[model samples]
Target: MTSEKRSIAVRFFGGAGNYTTVLEECCTHILTSDPTEAALVEWVKSNTKATSTDGIRDRLRFLEALELLEIEPERVRLTETGITWVSQTDPNVLFEQLDATVYGFETALEALQNGPKTDAELGDSIANTHAEVNWNDPSGPAQHRGWLQSLGYVERSDGLNSLTDSGRALARRRTSDSPNFQRQTYYTQADLEKAFDTSFGSYIKGINPRTDDHGELSYIIVKAREDGPYSDELDGERFTYIGEGVPSKGDQTLTGANKALLEQAEGASVPVYFFYQPADRSDLRYEGLVSVADVRYVSADERDRRVYEFTMERLDLEHPTEFETLAASVTAGEREETDSDANDGTNAGSEPEPALTAAEDEYTEVQRRVRSSAFAKRVKSAYDFRCAICDRSRESPAGTVDIEAAHIYPKQENGRDFIRNGLALCRLHHWAFDTGWLAVSDAYRILVADRPELEGYEEFSRLEGAQITVPPAEDEQPHATFLAAHRELHGFESV
Candidate 1:
């Protein structure tokens, strides 16, 4: 649409720009604010390390030519495209625009497709096609290289420029005859592998939990769709994620990818990057960083097993990682620990510190409480706020209910907070279950202790062989595992 009006008149900085950092910062400043041309320069001088406004002008002109900025007699502002880019800072949007609008982008990419080349080779290839951009022999190509490196499309080492994984994908797309130009196909697995320095082979479609070459925790790549039986859902700002599962008969425990995600909820410092595609679609579109908000082990109807469900709070970060377009997403460095310098007079420095810092310990506790609350809510909802034994439902005009959530296996015995391991009970039944005077058979039949002295035995004996109420969803039903554990512990196994 902007073809006739736009031209390659704006040339960018020459060589690997030392001012690239300042250039990016200045670009963000311009995109986020409304500043006149003169004011833009002054803002850069006051906010950044640049002594001169030369760098700011160069950045502005480059952005303008890319159609990311709109200039007028009255005021200057970012275009629609520029607003989207600044919001996520996704470099893919910017680079794709450049490849189409800018003259040398495609040429440089094509030249590098053959092999590694010096700036001279890249410049000459571009000059042969579009000769308008030049000051001297290498000026055109050097500027091209500077822009490429800044966008993370190409890298220069040992005086030669090579296409990064991001650049190669762009190059392939430019030369390919395939017309599948969907957004998710922007970057492939190679780009993700190179971005985090992670060398995991062949990622499974949904979740790939991995460690880096340093044998340290890296990241978890979750490829999901928006809506389906098992698709991940973005609920407001928190992403609801279901863990990986198997087709086996038994329940899915917290292991493998499930365990990897649990580590973060336990206060492990690792980033969880989310990507999504349409249902039954290939490839993925990158979303941003997410912090583990809560985790729970529960049954999924489709999988017919208890899997980990993670509640991840999306994070808005200033720095995105080096992956194509996702650079607007995030990049995290490994945390450094140094306590060797703290040597007390007793030489107690030989001992290791506690696993978590105070803040992390507090966060873990918070997650535990959140999981407990979720379990209780689900159990109460499943039983309709009625006791499984007495079926007594208490409700007030204020919407308060008298139902209590009890753990069948007991939390004091290190039992996990799981829906199937929980029961909704009135105060009387809750006390009886905890006292081993009342229990549920593996068949879900209520059992009353034969002890004649028991207070509720006469009333409970009426419904001894009757089935308890359960949730409509089969997965929400209390599992036989928890039932058997309760029965055995209470010496009601023969009942």
Candidate 2:
């Protein structure tokens, strides 16, 4: 088999770098009984970590391409070739078949056997054999080079390319399998931090890690700002953000960055990290290893452009205590400066706010005002100063929003001032939530109390069954116990 044949086979398999596992699973299911497309899709969703139907469909298409499974109008069934492929004990043979069918491998082997050649040279040499591929097309050559490197058939050094020992052996037909070949593995946040040992920005710019032919892991740095496209909130356990469409840069489309980010989230083989820096602070305060929890794309500034409304959950890890401390200090300093300015007749004509009555007093005794400020800043910063419930964020004259951090469990009821214990909400939603007119289910769905007073308000009624915005991290989610206690107290049924 030649590289061109291998390339065709790879394309037939939907251009997936790793199809053996998916094939095995698909074959096993169909072997027992023919399953409907919906059934198979549901099975993939339930059994595997795949979160979308599109991903499952892609795998099914790959199986179909390889003649491993035949898709009828109603159901899918395995073919003889698929059964044989599934029963094979060694995957090396399957890999060999793929190598023989692919297009660039032969050119790579030949070039390496003679002398070292750059990716362009190899691509040009291969282009002579394939009429469809143009060597001048940057993407085609880049992809060929990438595929060769990923298979361990080529090595690059000092802007020059050469063959590895495995590459040489592969070229000489000494072995069907490359000695250096191994499947890509997921890396934890600690693993990445140790590997880079630098600021998140620097790491992202310097190194873009890719597994197989999938896209590179995008290292996005979100600077917390009022009236920005996204807002982020962090509890000790998780970091959450709602991102809108990124603005276009020069000739770039508005949704370009957002689309890429969403793809990274959806197709990511490894966990992605989000490093958030406060607008008022210099250092990145939160570093969270995250996964895409949800995605909803909507029309943005232009008719063609779309904004990605999404959420990310933080992996379980220790809180960055030092970062939190630094953030708190910055908040305190800002508050002091604001207070000083106010005292210096900055608001001379403004009326003094009415004091809270004894009966209406909340957080006066249980939560220290200064400590609460820090908590509010952290929570609001995480959510980008937006209301988590309504997504209502507006910049004030002072370049801040009117959002307030409402405790999920009240401080007076022994709820500590923790990031997980709070939610950034608009005034109305916060008041309604605190007064038991609104409550959240354990699943984060909004539950309205059966009250006559709330019936006429269309806004409140419309939100009756909607889910509240929640932190992406499982640990940062509103505690079930807290929600249950609130529901029980308000005479609502448990979720």
How much lDDT does each candidate structure score?
0.64, 0.54
Question: The CA-based lDDT of model 1 is what?
Answer: 0.64
* Regions of model 2 farther than 4 Å from truth: 1-370, 396-399, 453-457
Candidate 1 weakest lDDT stretch, 10 residues? 328-337
TM-score of each: 0.38, 0.27
Q: Which stretches of candidate 1 lie over 4 Å from their true place?
A: 5-20, 31-33, 44-59, 129-138, 176-495
- For the record, the alpha-carbon RMSD of candidate 1 to the native fold, in angstroms, is 17.9
Q: What does the lDDT read for residue 20 in candidate 1?
A: 44
